[model samples]
Target: MARPPLRNDLIEEITTRVLDGRLAAGARVNEVHLARELSVSRTPLREALIGLAGRGLLTAEPGRGFLVPPFDPDEARRLYTLLAELEALALRWTSPLELAGLPDAVDAVADEMVAALERGADLSEVDDRWHALLLSRCPNPHLLRLIEQTKPLLKRYEWCYFGGVPRAGESIGEHRRIAAALREGDLSAASAMLVRNWVSTVAFLRKDNGDQCASE
Candidate 1:
């Protein structure tokens, strides 16, 4: 059987499964069963699990293997807070020339997202593309890595609340503002909007999830 490259494909598949709620949070990762189900061997599956554990999606337990970390509102807040800061920093680090050039690409992504929302397609993938475009000018590899690490975790909350594109109209308007700021080479404005995008989502989750926010 052909094994998809574990570093990228496997990890992405597992992350999708987790995000889609197929691999429930706090559920134990059964490597044997998962490997069999995926038609791969144990080694690659274990490697993928370890990669996820390192990314904070799964927690390691001695002897018992990896388990999905329980959702904690405090921890979610901290992660989202850090994510906002890191993304803002990335925008600051990006070059003005590059930022000025992103409008067309950003518009394309936003258009696709809007179309997808109307079609009831996967909004997460569209959202990822939009955010990725915003960070396209960031030169620091380490900072980009940190941003990637936080994305999947934040995505869990995003899925819980937005279900891909519930707030599509408002979100499209926000994207336009961010893209316009970037086109004008206004890094400070762009950075603020980037932070607002995430922090606002956290707020939305808090408002909608209510008493269940902590458990989610």
Candidate 2:
């Protein structure tokens, strides 16, 4: 229960900014400003940026320090597909006993998503919670860590995807179906539903964005 090292904390903090669109795609990260704002020395902040760059959450240029990568629909498609497989594998690897109560837990998180939507709140946090719950029983730490690392790459797009309240509501329905599959003790069906959820998002983004590439 101890706190993570300051470097890890800094990485999460910066990743959150990127996810929420505060850092924004294609914008150069101002190391001095961030270090000052976070009340940390430049050394640790730089290290964190380097780590994020290594993780594909940030880009490192020869002389430009760190930059937020622009949102590329093709890249998003690839990441979404990769994440879908990873998550499905995680679900399959999870012990059946550990998943016995997962359907109810997932449904409860879906309820939270419903409440968030009803009040015009963002669904991203609740959505994240639901996925984390779905895979919480997976015994493979390495797979879980890979999923964790890959998710942020698509979060900015997800934030935009869920910005449409109607789309967010549709996602809730998808979650329910996945939960239902779990309730029926159908892990294969549940995994398929989960993958469909991700696939549908990718299709939606492609249609929504069309030929317009995000500004870099």
Candidate 3:
């Protein structure tokens, strides 16, 4: 079963705050203040904090409650690496027939992403939809769950490095190429593109962070 709507909404709201740095890393969450600010109650707010903790966005202490975890660039790169590997596994396990009918959904989401980019609007939700559709052909529930688990951490890196940048335009082209490859039943090509997409994302983030490993 899905989480309650209030809990889910609180979770998303808190996540956005964390990703965009409104809730800075290492900052302690004042439950009362946050609940009043968000117009939510303690129960759902606590549930949201617990959910975020599970997603690696928050550290929950027995007496101190929750605090945003410090963003570690190396750890972010490692998470992206893991995400790429799991997504590649999904592509490998998905047969051509499983994806023959899914390109339309992927393309539609890509179109929305493009529109959002052109309008200088937030593309996070559309970007999520695009990737979710791209991997919908994968039949492994565990792989899917793992992919979902890494998204919050990945999005924090994205917000830190890619926000207000034109990265989405290039990403749309990559998305199209992957979708086209999948439509042609070229699993290898599609999987390669998916991995490249994620690897390139890590590279870009590293460069933005001025990491020595960016050249590596």
Candidate No. with top lDDT: 2
Candidate 1 at 204: error in angstroms?
1.1
Where does model 3 exceed 4 Å of error? 1-9, 36-47, 162-166, 206-216
lDDT string, candidate 1, 1-216, tens digits: 564565567788889888887888778888888887777788888888888888889889998898877667666667778898998999899888778789889988999988887887766678788888889789999999989988888767654464234466677777888988877778788789888877776655544563364454
Query: What is the lDDT, from 0 to 100, of the residue 108 in candidate 2?
Result: 95
Cα-based lDDT for every prediction: 0.79, 0.87, 0.80
Between candidates 1 and 2, the lDDT winner:
2
Candidate 1, TM-score vs. the true structure?
A: 0.84
- Backbone clash numbers for all candidates listed: 0, 0, 0
Candidate 2: where are CA atoms >4 Å away?
1-5, 206-213
TM-score of candidate 2 versus the correct structure, residues matched by position: 0.88
- My TM-score estimates for the predictions, one after another, are 0.84, 0.88, 0.78
The alpha-carbon deviation from the true structure for residue 9 of candidate 1, after best TM-score superposition, in angstroms, is: 3.8
